[model samples]
Each structure stands twice: as C-alpha cells, then as structure tokens.
Target: MAVKIYGIKNCDTMAKARHWLEARGVEAVFHDYKALSIGQDVLEGWADRIGWQKLINTSGTTFRKLPDEDRADLDEAKALRLMQAQPSMIRRPILDTGDQLIAGFKPDIYENVFK
Candidate 1:
C-alpha cells in the first residue's frame, strides 16, 4: 500500500516531511485535513494505534489558546472533539505506512520507516 500523510498543506513541518519523502523517491498521498475535514472514525483509528494523547498537538497555538476549562481534564472523547473542531490542534505530518502510524517528522525515524 502507498504511504499516506495527514497534515495541513501549508505547514512547514508538512513541507519538510513531503520534501524528505520526495528526495528519497518515496511516493505518498497527502491528506490535508485543513481543506477537508477529518472523520471521527479515522481519528479514532489513529488514536487506537498511537494513543489519543499523541494525536493532539498540545504545543500548538490552537491548543495553547484554548480556555483552561477546555484544556483541563482531557480524555479520548474530549480530545477528539477538540481536534475535530480545530484540525490545527492536531499534530502535523502524521505518516501512515498502512502498517504503522508515525506522528511528526523526525529524520531518523523517517529513515528507519523507509528502511
């Protein structure tokens, strides 16, 4: 199966990840959740594989700007709602190799994935 990348099209990290894959001749289809909304089922599947905690981009401005009440007491359902409402709150460049899910862009990890 082909590699599938999920992220916002204009994200710098997404660009880096795409460039890295292209440089190595790795073909991947990018899913820009910003333009197209992500489904709850898809998000749930990812969460099951990598854990919901890893799916949320707590370090991003979207997350930081959230009211303390909304940010506090996070659980799978709450996190999913937050992410669905604001895709930017989700992490960038989530690489799905069909067999595994890789969150974020780490050169070494990506190299290992290709290898």
Candidate 2:
C-alpha cells in the first residue's frame, strides 16, 4: 500500500507514530509540513475527508497564538485558508494510506488501519 505521513519531525506524536509504523515494518513517505508547505487543494481534500474540526488543531501552540479574531467563527473555507498559511495549525501525523486517510495517532486505530 502507498502510505504518506505528514507532520513536523520534532512533534512528539509524530515521532511516536513514525516509530510505531517503523516497528511494524510499514513503509511510509514522510512529509514535513514545515519544509513542504501544504496547499489549499490538499487542505481542502483533508477537510472534506475528515471535516474542518478534525483537520484544525486547536490544541497546538500555533493555533493558540492566532488572534482571537482569527480563531473565532471558523468555517470550512476559513479553516482551509488558515491551514494553508500555517501548516502547524493542522493536526499532526495525517496519514494518507491510498485507500483511506487517518488523522492523529492512536494505537488501536493504527493497528486496525495498517495491520
């Protein structure tokens, strides 16, 4: 299967997910959003697949640093635009497994999808 994981290298969750995949011998391409910018098309696709709430990482420092005005009243279009501008505002370890897309890493979810 063709699998690609997107996130920053230093992120703890990203590190864990990468380690998990490596331990299980699952090959995947890694896309560091910090180095490789995420475009509107890709952000929109992820939003469509998982919805804006799931795509946006409100818990991240990037999101917290945003102005209150920017964070308020978010819709799909606005969220996509913001994510395009600040890739770190999006959730980490977004996995594109050809057949499906998985956001965030959970042991049970990873096992079910990858194993």
Clashes of each: 0, 0
Candidate 1 has a TM-score of 0.98
The regions of model 2 sitting more than 4 angstroms off are: none
Model 2 CA RMSD to the hidden true structure, in angstroms: 1.0
Runs in model 1 deviating more than 4 A are none
Per-residue lDDT of 40 in model 2:
82
| Residue 87 in model 1: lDDT | 94
lDDT of 2 at 99: 80
Error of 2 at 5 (Å): 0.3
lDDT of 2 by residue, 1-115 (tens): 6799999888999999999999999999999997889878888888788888898898889989999999999998888888889988889889999888888999899999965
TM-score of each: 0.98, 0.95
TM-score of 2: 0.95
What is candidate 2's local distance difference test score?
0.89
The global C-alpha lDDT for each of the candidates, from Candidate 1 onward, is: 0.95, 0.89
RMSD of 1: 0.6
